[model samples]
Target: MAAPKPGHRRVLAAPIGLALTVSLAFLPGTASAAPQNVALQTSDGPQLSYVVNTKADAATIERVKKAAATAGGTIVVAYEKIGVLVVHSANTNFPQQMRTIKGVQSAGATRTAPLQAAVTTEIGAPEYLAGSPAATATDVPGAEPLEADQWDLRAIGADRAAKINPGSSNVTVAVIDTGVDDTHPDLAPNFSKSQSANCVGGVADTSEGAWRPYDPASDYHGTHVAGSIAAARNGIGISGVAPGVKISAIKVSDPETSLFYPESVVCAFMFAADHGVEITNNSYYIDPWLYNCLDDPDQKAIVDAVNRASLYAQSKGTLHVASAGNANHNLAAASITDDTSPDDTAPVVRTINPRECWDIPAQLPGIVTVSATGVQNIKSYYSNYGRNVVDVAAPGGDKYQIPDTPSKNGRILSTMPNNGYAFLQGTSMAGPHAAGVAALLKSTHPAATPEMLQELLKEQADNPGCPTGLYDPDGNGVADSVCEGPKPVNGFYGFGIVNALDAVTAP
Candidate 1:
């Protein structure tokens, strides 16, 4: 991700679709327990960041800013247009104190992590090391020599998709995750440096390479996802799903601390909307509160802040595409246990009413949600599914679940920092494919609104009927998960895996 010039990197350092009529969250795996490294999860004690929404009018905004100041918080950034103010406070009571202010519509700590938590590993990282090392250089006729190994691309027929339309540079898909390596040769050809910015600190920084991985060795998530969306049509590396579109990065997740808090996310959306981003691929979940409950004031405020930014982005013509998570649970269920909230702090397991609670941005309105499938076109073993949720599906690979050839590793391959490529599984990898397809659709139909795109996404999916009864892929005499809905649109493979070919050629 590109950071704003130094001045814009202000360190708050915090942190779809699927018009399936239902919703879900985006992320690779579940955080069922507290992190082992307490210090890295929390900063000095419990410094927290918050987004306070109020009336957009100057008087009300001033009142809100004034209230935050009085509440022992510093204004990191104040988005007057959305009437949202990002503030940081070490005071544990800052949220409650601000809520009592007259002009404040909602206020809450975005994360339980202490301010300035050190970034660490992303959600249960899977090893992508192949028999051979990824090379910095590449060959032509098909990008990288490993092109033959990218079964995920062929599985979804992206090569064929490109033949039909190849997409358009006018459309930009922002990878709002860790950070994208703009210099990666595979990505450079299509990277939109002007649109890339670092939003790691509750603000956008436009510095040179400001949006790059904090630690190239560890934070390759965004780059991988970005490559999947728009790597390049160049003869060097592998081509992306929509190699013609441009890519932008909004760095929100921190590699040192493995955190993606609220303030940073709110900022990312605003940046995407303010810029010319037409689509955004969100492959990570908003942490600190995995499932925010509307009844809980603190959680509600966090959700409200993000929803406001997302809605604003939508109004500006950005179609948000998110992963359906790798939790392997039924998102449409009435109740589920969330043992991880405030992931920065000790987590306590609590059951939640799915209908009453939500995984922000994913569950948020107007997003085009995407699920994952494997070689057999069956749901990825770990992907979350629900009849009311999951709008579409794409190739995300399944190492232990779905069997496949050419890529027996059973994971998706995309660009990595330092001009490399790696295999990665999980919905985290799945979302990019959907984002790429969305980009192609936007390019083909420039006049299509976010709503129109959402409809077309589902309309283009090649449906695969749900798995037999319990979906016991392991055959351990126990069911994996249940799929609810009928044909073309069901729980497992929502609308079926994404059809890039249809996306480009379909009328």
Candidate 2:
């Protein structure tokens, strides 16, 4: 998901920002340096985004609001329930100044980039082969034209699950990413427009089609993810994992940079929780830091705000399924080198302790963290994994582990904007497959809580156990990754690969 890998059509690299591995010793000032200097910019300086966390009480919130105003910050949206406020201020000192306030728990800027900068993200063009028809109605009875190309669906038994149950229309999975094109023929049937909204700048914009991608051509990430979760089984394009469940779009990615900042992501979680959304598929991480460290003030603040928001959503019965990131680092490792932080500005290479620095929403408690697998049901080469970190595994595709399908493309194929289709690979793609299965479980057990659904999902998965001998998929003599734990639950496959057939059929 970190910027599309070189061979893919496009990279929805929000959650997996630069998911490549690089080694560097711990930089001395990396954790100690302030995110930004207040002296560098005054009240008249460039506008910046900040998150202020406080006690979730009316009195405390009010006091913080006043303090924010006095610090030269304007309230973008106040999530009073979580006591998280998205603030905009030109005062570079606002974060430092707000920290001094009595009620403020944590305060920091969300990014290094200014508000007006037209951040450029290299979004690969949508891939389409002219005259290459996806499929015909006669190919697979009720299956879509591209159904044959979707090895991912069969790998997880989603193709068979459809016969038993397509999922409950009452259950909805919110794709909280770039945006979703509900207008796509494959997605329109099961799209929940009423529940969808654009939470771009910490505000919920419910305008008609407000959840549509800012630019369908390049902002196709969310739509692709949505298609994998709930694209209808109509004889049109590709079919999603849980083709009968409803899906809503909560656009949180910035239009220009395609970045999912903390404020927008927090707003999205709060929106989904309040809107009766049963599940959320978080394919993108709250950027610019790949790992939000507890030691860093700004990073810690991001961790706090996002944790609060996710907790609020969970309490409202919203089960969160997130990608474990594309970086192949062992999440449970003692130390990991991350060269990508503050991606909106210049990134600093630093060594981080995984225990303290986390890949939020995914590593956060209660989230069903997913790692990617390929056609062979082995861990994808680029998926991040840890024995206790990953909750489940799903088909996110592997170019090296080619499938025997017609397309023969080792990537997940799903609906794109403007009736298009493309192949993408990442834990971003894997999370949706698990999310779709969760939707099926929710559909079957209408009264199940988020905890219950998670348990059921894990119970129903097929544990392949750890791979025999060296776990090297690319066949390199050197091990690409080490598999830890017992077969039932390991770093590479978690509780093992998700089973869609079991999801809908289990008692």
Candidate 3:
């Protein structure tokens, strides 16, 4: 793939910041507004919103105290936390106003939209082939030679951890995608029922529920992604990056259509953050909108919410990783400018390359955005690149046809839903490899914060065949020589390709 052309940074044109304010006054008839709350996304944690109370003022407090004295109702839950207040009333019909509430200017519920399911097709069992391998020669006492017909799990770093007893049994990685097939023989053993949820359209048994665990639906994308993250390594057709790590399958996408809405993504992020998932993998992206300022009123509010949620997860040390995008455009490029006049003269010229830019949630700050690379450690022909936006790259595979050479086909081989296997390609396939590696690093370094883990991974990456003297115009380059360029991190290959052993043992 060619390097992205230089383009100007275009900030998104939207209002994203505005403080929320609320006002409340007592009214007749005690009907309530169904517990108004706002899901706030913070930089330091997951989602948190305020619970409004109509009787929080000094006068109301006094009245409540008197009412409790008279009614023998004492406040059990304390609202001592600043900006947090609660009210209790015996009048089921107690009339309360919700017009004014501090820190809560509006009452809106946030939910994750539906995610599209991944398509699945059978690729058959592995066939041992006589060819050069990516890793050093090692012997599995009783294991059979890997089948060539099977997907190449080892090339993408899954086999390394598998050799060391699969993964740490205690760790569970969250796969927040379309629902998964929990009954698959290769995946059932490592799936955790307590940590799974099908958040698709808030429905049960319908099309949305088909992706839920034990459901007879074919929503296999999450299963595939999860299998790649931690498929059971019990002498099966394939192994996962963290074979022993239990999987928390959170189905947020649709099983039939591969489509997902933004709200669902937000909900999924919050769910993972709130849960004890040490690592969350997002292999999807939204179309890129030109630079929207970090403080646009609406954008800022949404981003602030997301950042707050991420911050909350980080507080507990959860790592969030996503795919940079498949579009081969510079992430920092300016929006397309139309030069043609009114329709009478000539046609208007709009930008032809939409996928050229990095998509949202991935482009969101603080999240790891990964790109894809092919065999021989070169960038994948369809993989996107941006020194400023993409944080790293991994072996996602390629499909190049070389004359008389059995066509060098590239596809990421990993576990799928049901008792089957599959070959997937795309940055989607690459992101999970990185996520699994991050999980391994987290398991190895229990005390490290998410931020620390990210830094460590970059610091321990291994540089392969990157070019020298290819300066990034953005001035983000830290090293001058390709070999010496910023030893641990850079825009392209964010710290270079991940080194499993180095990341697992980093000081």
Candidate 4:
């Protein structure tokens, strides 16, 4: 499938009257309450996942168990209505049979997969570029400087007051994406102390001794994303959003092929959540095949699991930041209605009528859904927006002009894969930038809860594209009026482009 293109459009449709419901099965298991922290039931039982479709009942449970048994495994979790079952394979050979079982559906490796071999061909390391040591280093050839770097570190400052702080040693941010180039001089110093299993699969080669716990694959997406968050700022290459921060690389997606299963992604999340990591950044979005409300039961189950894991992370005081999605249509407005029309799977293209909304994961209550903005202080042409859905916007590079070009402003610069640098334009890139900013805030304000961190980020946001007075035409105060011209908290630029300095300094 082609990569999802970026663009935002108003979604005009009726509200989804159905409320998200959860069903209780067996007494809440350890995994159920803390989906992301999966403690092996017996140290031998397959890892448990707490996220299950509560709508599933006893009958559904029996059906899933029977299917798993036939496939030579046991059902760890059963999600009836959503059609998802977490099965632990007693043996590895039954993987194929497990897929064939009636309700078994797709399966992921119960054990960790190895990373792909690293590139044998040696390439000269790029010249290191010096950046301001006081703030985040922005050395990308054409990348714009972050306005937020000027402020004191929010989370870090808070931590200092409490006397419990992350001095270079305790702060770690996990970049769960394609994979990282451990050998990259710019990223090597900050690699985690111990490596973990690759949820995706295969062993990664570390020819230059920079190998960490992440799996290796052709995909450079994870590596690039990692660089942006915590690439080493040792006076070489470009600096990261949080230069003082360390990086934990977890390869969940293949950047080269963009091929990744939902199960692998979930496992990666669980791994990060269980381990003592401060934050996890996810740049990927939901697949169209699985986004349908009435799609395959297993697909729905996986989506539910992802949400569960996210909640679990939050309960641990660890934030799980995800991309709002590239689709321009309002997620709430777009849904799988009972209509049997032929074009049901077709993309939703309609203008939002007065007083309607749609969005996903972003719409998911607790998750932080970030939007994108360009240099001109306007919303990125590809950014999706809804007054209530998008929590905030950050600098996503613009395609119209060269980096630093007077008229062609708004592109954010950070490290790219292969020791090279390029201005990536998309919410995918924008989300991480904000995540990095959040990491910085978290470092400063150790006592701030995830909710508090989010609130501070919004309150300190610089309003743009709207008037100074109440711009919310909807009266909800959630959706600001676009007519007032973009302001810090207006619809076009949620809370105004992220002001790193203000976020850190705000009391």
Candidate 5:
């Protein structure tokens, strides 16, 4: 989610759920270095966002209001049901001060980022056709012009799944991402107008086109994700995995393309829960720290706030699906390196244990963590792998590793911003495939629970043993990363590639 600028201010690469990946450093005067009883950090200016957790009651809410006043912090949006409050503060020590208030369960600066984050991400240089036009042809009922190019559809057996069940129009899958281009021809047919809203500044805005993507650099991500899940089978462009479902654009990313923050993320899930959303596709991680350690009080509050929001959504029957991430490190490993912290500012390098520090929402409880695979049914070079963490695999594309074909560009293609289509690759791209399958399952069995869908996903996966030896697809004559686990289930493939066909046909 980090913006692509260098020097003075570092990158704000919030690639948790996008195809964009860039390394950056943390800056000063950010939330991660929350100071005590002070408004300004010696290094940076006054600008901060914090999340406060308290008991769910009126008395605690009053105290929370008073505490915010004393600390020069203002409430952005407070989730009374879950006891989570999004606050804007100039006081660097606001979090430290808030902890002293009675009835406060936890308090922490949500992100190590400033109020107005600046970030830019590249989706990839897609292979645009010679005469691709922004205006798509009239709709009919068959394969779209680009349907043959969608290898991801066949890879997950979505074609077979469609034969079993084309899904129901009643089911809506929310794209909790940068934003979705609801106006795209392929998406407009199945777009749920009432379910779309912008949670950009930590508050839900339901104005017309409020959830539409505007930033040219990163907005394409959410749109691409929506198409992958439910682009209509109108015989024009491409077909989504579950073309019979509807898509909701829940915008959470900011204007500068900064990463999704805890406040926005919380609001997104809550909104989905309240509006009857059946499933959510999360391709990005909450910004700033890629791994929030539980030991740190500030980081703990962030994790707690988000966990509460997601849990509440699940309680309301919404399935939260998250991407495993593009980093190639083994999450199942005992330890890992995270050099990017407070990425909104300047970052500091650090090493940590996975059990204590988590790549949130993905590693968070109840989330269905998805891994990425290329056209060849092998793990994508950049996808993170874990025996205990990853739940399933799907086609996210691999430019260098997979075999080439005009249609198989080794990248997933879907609706771009202007009613057009383009390619992108990442674990960010894989989660939606699973979400689409889950939507089909939900459509086929509306009475099913999240637990039921999760079990069905793993059960239907086509299990294959781990590739023997060093699995390096780049052919650099060196091992890229080693595969772990066994057949039927493994660290890289997680139960094996997702089988959408079995999901709808299962008895």
Candidate 6:
């Protein structure tokens, strides 16, 4: 496959296919409580995954589970704490029919792909890096061998922060993406095997080596993200933002498609919360729909279930940091066009109200939505922004924002699979930087709640305000994006660029 686009990272190309025709007439609060007999046999069509949501009560869950079985749905996993059940069923009308069951709050299919098998197609091998960049640094004494090329570290003051406090070993930030390569030298020192798990099918598989990438070459996204957050500060390779902290993997992306579905994401958050994880980095959005609308029952169910899981994690003291996408669209805008929805199958182009349609986990409340910045401290050309949507900014890299390093590459350099290092850019890269700083804060204040950690992140950030004049980084006459709000908090940079030094030293 070709290199991932600048804004979208690790997203596989959507093959053109037909969508399964399903009814959209299901409405919440309109279903009857009366019992009805529905046949319980799996259909001949491809098996699909669905999320049956109910009130967070044992009685309600039990009732739903019985109803689900009668509706031809086999329970994959049941999260009683959130009242969300992952179910596999071949019946095409499972979602529509489940919505009418008593005690069932909202239900819908999680992905456009069938549940029988994951979509795996190796179009081509990803371009891999075998060695460090051709850069020598004699000025920055005591720095790691490849740290000089990590302009992102210096940009966030993480280079200076590490001297004061390299975070704490007890603090763990979960990388909830594709699986990670824990054997890499740079990441092996700080890798926490006990906290890692494979959550590909909405279930936690903690077997030995289960958290590794399914394919080393194509499934290298999570390894890069882990290296950015907590790669050890050893002498051989690049140092992470919070080098002293431990990092774990929660593999959510599917094998070949690399798509993150709602069931997997919900499992990741729940697993992180139940486990001792203090923070989570979500760089990818939920698949199938780029923007889920609240008015639509199916989309609304996805939004509700994901938000419930995230809130549950936050309540349990886990801070969530997410990327603000790469579309470059203002999330605070009145309207926007989404042409890539139902991406696992065919898509329908349509205009949507931004207020009603949201990019899950990122646009969701309480998630620290981070925008991407370059070496110049300006918003990356492809970074999505909004007045209240973006909460902070970090180095996600810009091909146009040339760095002064020997390699002169504008992207971030981090660990890849098989003892390799590579340069890649996206808001996917930006979220981990913030997560690293949040981990540093967690190390400093071990007793702080998720709310406190989030406040500290914004309060300690260095506010650069918004850029003056039309925002155009390409030097072309055409304007790229518009900034909003005052200097301290704006659409582009949010509260400001995250300050790693402050994170380690803040009271």
Name the candidate that leads on lDDT.
6
lDDT of 4 by residue, 1-507 (tens): 234322222222122211222311221111122232222222133332212243245664575466456545655444343444555555444443333333332333422222223110001122222444234435543223432321112212221221232224456777766666766766778877354336542223223323232333235456666666665546554556666677877665443334444445555556666677777766665332313222223333444545455555666776766565544433333332212111113444434321222222334335566666555445555555655456666665545323343223334444545454434556666676677767767877777777887777677666665444553323475632232224544455555556555544555
The sequence of per-residue lDDT tens digits that candidate 5 reaches over residues 50-93 is 98887778887777877777788888888988888888888877
- Of candidate 3, the 10-residue stretch with the lowest lDDT total is 1-10
Q: Model 2 over residues 213-280: C-alpha lDDT tens digits?
A: 88887778899999999988877778899999999999988877888888888988999999999999
On residues 63-161, what C-alpha lDDT tens digit does candidate 1 reach at each position? 768666766778999988777888888767776666656566677778766666422112245455444433534443444556666677788788878
Q: Give the TM-score of candidate 2.
A: 0.90
The predicted structure with the larger TM-score, 4 or 5, is 5
Lowest summed lDDT window (length 10), candidate 6: 15-24
Model 4: residues with Cα > 4 Å off, grouped in runs: 5-67, 71-169, 193-197, 201-218, 254-257, 288-290, 294-299, 330-363, 401-410, 466-489
lDDT of 4 at 63: 54
Q: Specify the highest-TM-score model's number.
A: 6
Q: Please give the distance, in angstroms, between residue 238's alpha carbon in candidate 2 and its true position after superposition.
A: 1.5
- Candidate 6 displacement at residue 291 in angstroms: 0.7
Q: TM-scores across all candidates? A: 0.87, 0.90, 0.63, 0.63, 0.88, 0.91
Q: lDDT of candidate 4 vs native?
A: 0.47
lDDT of 6 by residue, 25-144 (tens): 243333444465654444556788888888778988898898888878899999988788999998888887887777777788887778636211111233344555334444678798
- Backbone clashes for every candidate come to 37, 5, 58, 59, 19, 0
* lDDT tens digits, residue span 37-70, model 3: 4222212222222122223256544443333333
Q: Give the TM-score of candidate 5.
A: 0.88
Q: What ranges in model 5 sit over 4 Å off?
A: 1-45, 117-123, 130-141, 403-405
Model 1, total clashes: 37
Off by over 4 Å in 6: 1-44, 116-137
